[model samples]
Target: MDTEMYIEKDIYVECLNDIGMLEIENDEFFMSPYIRGQRVIHKVLPMHIMQTIFYYTLTLGEFNCNEESVLKTWDSRNEDRFSLEMVCKRWCSIIKASCRSLVLSLNNLEANTFRITHFTYLKKLEIINNVNNDSDYSDYDTSDDEDTKDYSNNDLYYDYFDQRKNITYRRRKRVPNKNSDKLARCLSTTIQLSLPNLSTLNLSMSNLKERHIETIKSALASNKNIKKINLDGCPIGDQGVVFLSEILESNNTIRQLDLQSCGSINGLEYLGRAISNNNTLEKLIWSYNQSNYTSVICLSNGLRNNHSQIKSLILRACDIEGWGALSLSDTLAINKSLRELDLGSNQLGDAGAIALASKINSHPSLSILDLSSNLISTEGIDKILLSIQSNKTLTNLNLSRNQLDLSIPLENLTSSLELNKNLISLNLSECDLQNFHFKQISIALQSNKKLKKLNLSKNNFTIIEPFITIIQSNKNLKSIYISKHKFKSNELFILLNHIFKLNDSIKLDNGEVVNIDIPSIVHQLEYIDLSQSHDPLTKNIILLLREFRKVNNITKIKI
Candidate 1:
């Protein structure tokens, strides 16, 4: 069985010597007494089912599993957890005691931050003390600066054929001395002597203050099982949100709080009464804080009449208006545990979209409502599609870039998107849509069987035949975005080889025994973004998205 699924256990080399997972000083950690007593063992593949099939094939996934992090499979990754830490010292202490997360970096932490504080099966600790706004240090700082290399430049490797070029890497700015005080003394001695099964602490845009959040909320509020804390765009002020609202009112085990783009989100009325006497906060993103309208009615009067256990409230582009829409529609009719409300790109005109379309169908566990871009026309798009036409737990509705003059009440917003039917993802992107508003939303999605993801991306759109005849008359349209148009590089190079020969004549004239969920001849197009067009149609749309993504694997072509 692949030679005992590459056996290399010795009680994970005593959990990598009780924790200091060989943090250097190597001769490959003295390859453990030459395979110490290995008698070609494999008594019918036991060892905890081959160590749970070797950690399910070295997965770097499942951190809220939204896979396809821009698909860089690199030949299905799992280099057997880096060739079992280079095939030595009992497979390098069984791949360093299956370590769990450690994204540290105050740039070469004064010689391996005390052996990265002996990983002792760490849980999740991302300290990144700033590196030109680190996104995991701009995705693993890809080398090659050799003091501005010039190796007689082979014209910088032909600049990737110059047409849709993407070769960037110029990082050379390390000046962070005179006190991050050696990263707050190695984060006050690695949060007071190594991660005791730490739960998750991102510390984003890391230059976090208030004595590193009072020495990280007094060592994560005495291990109160810190659940999540991002501190995004961190330069946290208002006394770091009043010492993180007094550690979220004496930690009831924090749930998730991002505080994105925090240009000092000064006392959002002490983070809305410390999130109304918090009870395990369940997401409070507070996006791009550039607040107006009395700083969103002093943060929507601490999210009006709140009875904690908060449930998702994004607040994108926080420029909310006119009494930030009567204090966010009276805090959405007395916040009964909100269930996702984005408030996208907030310009929120038309009296803040008619004060949240007159109390948005009294939030029945509001299932995702984004009000995108917010130019909200057609007199607040007919009171936000007549309050999402009897919204029964809205399933994603983002009236995108609301320049929405949806052609002056395009049949009452296509009869409220063909009578809502509990929306299933809709985003009318840059909504000034035409061709008679795409044939009145393709005749209200012909007896609309719940919208299956649609976004009519930026409308410089020159009628791509009524969006491919409304995606060939939507039989539950899977996904669409009609990219940013302005074509003409020889008519988008003959409409990119006639849409890859019409997706190889509908996957070889629907042969291969049909049934791939035949929603109208095996419904294709699971996703398509075609980024920003005309760079000479980027090498024929990257050779028709690498030969139509090898004839199907949920067709996702985003140039």
Candidate 2:
């Protein structure tokens, strides 16, 4: 039998070779040849049957169908595994068994009813109702008069509850009741059966109620492995938050919690108390959730204690003014574990910025700081830059969307940055920078060789000579964004000429450059963005792109 099977395999290979359908080299390993053959074999085989065979062979060690394989099969945004399942029953079985996450938007009733039975092993389920009215639930019934009458009103809820209870009992050996019907069954089943190894739970965009919080608390009461939970944009307010706080106070495994846009300040305060003594919690991101100064004060006061373990704090758009920001900065200065702080889009003015910069200068571990969209002007920026000069651990800084003007002395700030060798990524976009500022930046770039990415877009700079000089000298720069800045015709030409001369590809914004030629040294270029640039010579742009493609073997061109 073995001899016959080997002969059949060889015959198959020979037939494929004759038809130019397979390209397998004998010098490679057995698995490599099989993988190569799979590509061609799948083309001839129906998708459903092919998936079944693929999984079966993989389980038998005759092929590879690991996590990467499953991801490749089901990672399409436009198409789901249903298409593959529709091709054959074999595929449907394999996909139903192997799928770990199922996202079903309950927009259509027929599709929801059809697929509900297949979610036996779904570890993560996202159900979104996009219908305009609750009456849309009536469309799923196509039964006898008696059955229709039974499912017409609140009976619909009872039927769904029963179905959920059955699924839960089948998977978890526990029958779900009315109290645990809505979100509890889903969470319980996910925790007990489907997601036994689940460590992260992201319940974003769910309309969770108070009872749902109790369900989650009950689920996490025994779970000791969950490390992260993101409840962003959920309608879990203060009461639900108190329940979550109790859970956090008890569970020590959760390290990162993202409650952004979820609860209010009072809820946050309660949560702070619950996890205040936790030594394992590292990152807490609670940005843009209508947190007031009282909440910030409460959090700041909580962090002042020795038991707090928060290392990174993000409080963007949290209604924090100068006093609140100053208080937070003071707290951060004292906190030893905090390394990154994001206070972007807040009401932190120059006083708040200066206060934070002072704290940052004294901070021993803080490295990355994002203070964008604050009301800080040139003076505030100068103060921050001066503090950066003294700060050794800080590396990445974002100062975008402030009212910084070219009148600010860039030479001093550049000199300070040069002294501080740890800076890597600098964002100075929309700071009203012009030619003189660019000249200063060029000098700084020539001196600072450690910087990798620079964003100077949306500024008032029209002359490109200084920027070109910086690009030519700054060999360490990997990416540069200079979008939305208008340039003169000569200036644009000069900029393109210098960029084409460089070995590293540069990203350009929308602007006109007449008769640009594809440079000979184009192989080193990786990306080019010429979107929204309506040049008079627009017809020749395609030829220019083709020439670039021919010279550099470009893989991506955005025009």
lDDT of each: 0.63, 0.64
Off by over 4 Å in 2: 1-52, 56-69, 72-181, 192-195, 405-411, 502-546, 553-559
> What lDDT score is found at residue 207 in candidate 1?
71
Model 2 lDDT tens row, 1-559? 1212131345656767898887655655464433455556567778766665647543544455456455322222335444444334555566666666555443322234444445455444444433333221234443445432443345343433356556421111222233223444455444544344446666674455556778768767566766777778766777877887787777788888887887566765776676566667788888877777777777887677787788888888887789988888889767887888898998898889888878877788888899999988887888888888778788899999998755556446667657777878888888887777778777777777677767877787667667666655666666676776666544554455455542233333355434433342222224433333424323334444455556655334343
Residue pairs in steric clash, candidate 1?
434-437
TM-score of every model? 0.32, 0.69
Q: What TM-score does prediction 1 earn?
A: 0.32
Best by lDDT: 2
- Model 2 collision count: 0
RMSD of each: 25.2, 12.1
Clashing pairs in 2: none
Question: Any idea what lDDT model 1 has?
Answer: 0.63
